[model samples]
Target: MKGIRGRYGQMKVLETELDSTVKLLDTTIFNKDNFYNALGRQQDFIIRPLLGPQKIRVNPVNNSLYIIESTNNKQHFTNSEDVYEHLLKHEFTKKNYVIQTVPANNQSVLHYHRFTLHRISSSSNWKVVHHSITGGNELGKIRHALPFLKFNKVVRNAANLLGNYYLACNTIVIEILQNKMGETWITDTILHERNSKWSQFHSLYSCKALRSYIPHTELCTKESLGKFLQSLRQVVLKPCVGQQGKGIVKVTKLDDNTFEIHENKQIININDFAKLYDYIHNHYLSKNDYIVQQFIVIGKIDDRLFDVRVMSQLDETEWIITGVLVKVATKGFFISNRASQLLTLEEALIWSNSKISFDKCVSLINEICGKASVVLEKNCKGITIIGFDIAIDSNGALWIIEGNYAPSTAMFYKFKYNEMYETIYKYINKNKKRFSPHSD
Candidate 1:
């Protein structure tokens, strides 16, 4: 009876081995060029060809698999043990292969591991595939994803609390900049201080301050605001909830009975001040929060407006300049530096050399940026990179236009590719050092 049981077990093992062999043979045959030639133009068969040859052997005793493949007509044996060891060292354990077809009948194959691949159909034929890959473990994920999440939530809350578009923009800018810049430089930082109530809590140079140049302003009623506007010969009315140089009206009192309102290049006469006020009140004013900021004429070049955007990063003790872009206003546009017509800083400097000394401008920029770094470390939580937009007047006085927390590195790649790569490599290395366990 015992001999019969042992024979049964042996038979079971033999059957398993035979099944594996059949599977390998089938895969090899399906992968052969002759098989494809015979199958001809079958779409399914063409698309689902076996990936590789099946001249492979599995050793259950040693938990290893071996594959024989020809490269340059020379056969090579690859052991699964070696392949797996290499993959493990490189952190490629969780892997996935995806094949997708687009509207233009184009196919894309993606291989990913330890990351999420999200595919969304945009239209009948158009599709967008997003691959978010993260190295390291749960702690790494938390460190990387949290800042952006917090930023989104903070923006949403600011938008809700501030009814005026300008006020909301101010709030978001100040919060982010202050966090990056810190609290000290914020106190006397002057950009445009509007509505002192909001300004009190969010002072320029402080983590709460939005526009850097403005002084602390008081929140005033519409009637008070109208009186203030009347006092000034010229004033700029900006919609609190606007961006990209939109909905800005520059009003200049001409004489006793007339006023000039400028929108872009077009100028119109304002005979009825009350009507103008009503227009602004209904369109720009909000229940949340808004500011009537004092405007200053920014420097111009060749009868056009332009601003310099300096990309910067802190490397240990040094503040490194990554790249600089000059935003030139389009023809008939009053404000330059809109997203549409952005040029490198070099281009802008060459074009507007007569207006300002490029070398001096850069020197001043670097100096101020160094100060900005000090502000960032003190106020902001975990910001490593900062993009500062500075507007230099004809007098060469630098004004803080705005600050971007997550600036794109595409512009940097154009001219400073090596610098950009080095920065990235350093950042990755720093992260590795921080996360990797130290050995005794």
Candidate 2:
């Protein structure tokens, strides 16, 4: 009673002496000995408690109610709702006390921030849950068994207040850079200048070994288009910022001084240079930023072109390749993507019919990817994760197709690469490494 009296002494005295009412609430209403009086005092300031082991205590210096949760008692309340139970148990008691115990384990918050793209409303698509550090399975499982975290339906943005680490899950590149949560790999965009294709081209163009992998690409201009067509009998046109084969066109020069443009199932032939220019210029090139590149005949599997998708991440100081998938082009499609059938790296290698050994290819791919990552990390800030889209040509040489900052991992998951996926997330969420570019 003395503790409660001291905690609310100022407010209690103010109410008694003034013969007025006071109320306090936080996610729930606080009972004032007199219910009617508390209801009436709703018009006045109320002190509500935060959901934690913290109690509403008074700061005598300022005569204000402040939260007090002891660090020593955190382990006892690993399940946050234990705090609520403590509050409920002491609700009608004459005296309240918080039992403190030495913390045997420590846990930190990992907040994933998600929001719908192209939406006007500024609301959070947040899920509050605890992911376990260890589980029955080898892969650490999400702690859905914890009742408190499981039922937390509301989005809580108390990272700053609670010292939680925030992760920009599904957030755009801009958000990752702006959020600035301890220099992670998600923001590595060293080669991503304006778009992936061009950014990758310019970034890798300097390395002689990587030069062959990068096709002859340039911004689509009238003069450059003609030269590109004249030099390379066949050229591919792609949106500088395209994905999943959207807005792609293949142009082939014919013997009759005409051009054949293939897009999806439709093929158009233009005999006049001016007409061909107009057809491509207004309809495709001018619509958005476009890049024209020399076409390389990709290795095929049963007559279908296939490309490799490698997902890599920085673990401490080492870059680890987490997942590898081979994307076979969909029937009649120019690009290999989600719609295309995917095969394991081993299966794809067998289908590829390349002379290079699997071990050698793996070594080359890793070396190239490592070099790219180093270059990217040097210039691009906040990029800790990268996905490389690579192609193996008929000549058995590797070509760099594109680099992605926010690549999809569905392929890995779809192909049953759970171990790799789990490892990547475990590293990210747990983040056990002491090395931080921002660390002193």
Candidate 3:
């Protein structure tokens, strides 16, 4: 009974504080006459007294929120929800306010302001107030009040507010930037394989299967491995846990006298099979689970090997293709990526189709991308963007080489320049619209 009474007393005090702060904001607006004067003007002018004269109005409808700060004249809407949430989370209702306004005639001239109350009710305590002004239908009459300020305070003090939900929404935005997918889709091997949905796709070999869908491959012993290697003409060994084209070797038997060893195109002739076996046994196969995959003869472009990177993103309802680029290998190297050298998709298509049709190559490339997305989404759920690296075989069949979660847009933007940048900007803005407060 005592605890409940104490809690009630605290709530009453908070309510009183909110009421006092709101009245203070109301008095400031009515006393200054500056805000009313601006509202009475027939011509549009942003009144941004909150952060001072230097801070431009941040009305979302205007799209000129940061016009004064930026030289490019492009207005970028910085997400202010995080700041709002911080105040609410810390129960700083006495220091927070929300802007209420009528629709503006031009919609682009409205402004938002934030003011600090240095001495509320003749006390040394400080508080923050937010205000918004918009043009109204009436010629010189405008309705203005601190109603939203009170409502926002009420919501902030409520026990079951949507504060956590709003925080989650903000976190989703942050995750998009940080590329933190989290550990959601990682499951068992059979399930992961089933999710991949590609019959030809195989899992990387590891001692303990990391993904539930991929089967744990057994390490090769000398007796069983010798029998396995004898059955194949050549095999490429890859580190199961490695990335970025590292720790890969191709072993092929030439004749009874010699064997060829290839590492990213550098070749060496080894006469002692025992020494070669010791090298593989000691360095690669000794400790880690390694996979012996069949070598793929990738199609050449301009007499140089290249792979296509198709980028895609998931919007509100559907997954859309953002752009594609070709990662061309350096003069002597075989792998093609930014780490190697990147070429525009158009350039690669042109070079590849000097002896073939560009349309045909694109069709094949799109098909591979479609399949890769299906396979990837099966393994990973709620994946918004992905880059699929694909290679075309001499037989014209497309092969999925790898997939990247956070793909680079540098090559795509560099190739198309302004056009691609604008496209991406528009896409981000569209997503922002989906999360507008009105959408709630």
RMSD, each candidate, Å? 25.5, 23.3, 26.3
**True lDDT of residue 58, candidate 2:** 16
What digit string (tens of lDDT, one per residue) describes model 2 on residues 261-288? Answer: 9887678898966677778876775345
TM-score (C-alpha, index-matched) for candidate 2:
0.53
User: What tens digits encode model 3's per-residue C-alpha lDDT throughout 188-236?
Assistant: 0100112121211332111122232232222233433443456665666
User: Which RMSD does model 3 reach against the true structure?
Assistant: 26.3
Error of 3 at 385 (Å): 1.5
* Top-TM-score candidate index: 2
In model 3, the worst 10-residue window by lDDT is 170-179
Query: How well is each residue in 363-394 modelled by candidate 1, as lDDT tens digits?
Result: 77787666665555333434566677677666
Q: Write down the TM-score of every candidate.
A: 0.44, 0.53, 0.44
Give the winner by lDDT: 1 or 2.
2
lDDT of every model, 2 decimals = 0.42, 0.52, 0.42
Model 3 segments more than 4 A misplaced: 1-234, 264-266, 272-274, 338-340, 353-356, 416-440
> Scored by Cα lDDT, where does model 2 land?
0.52
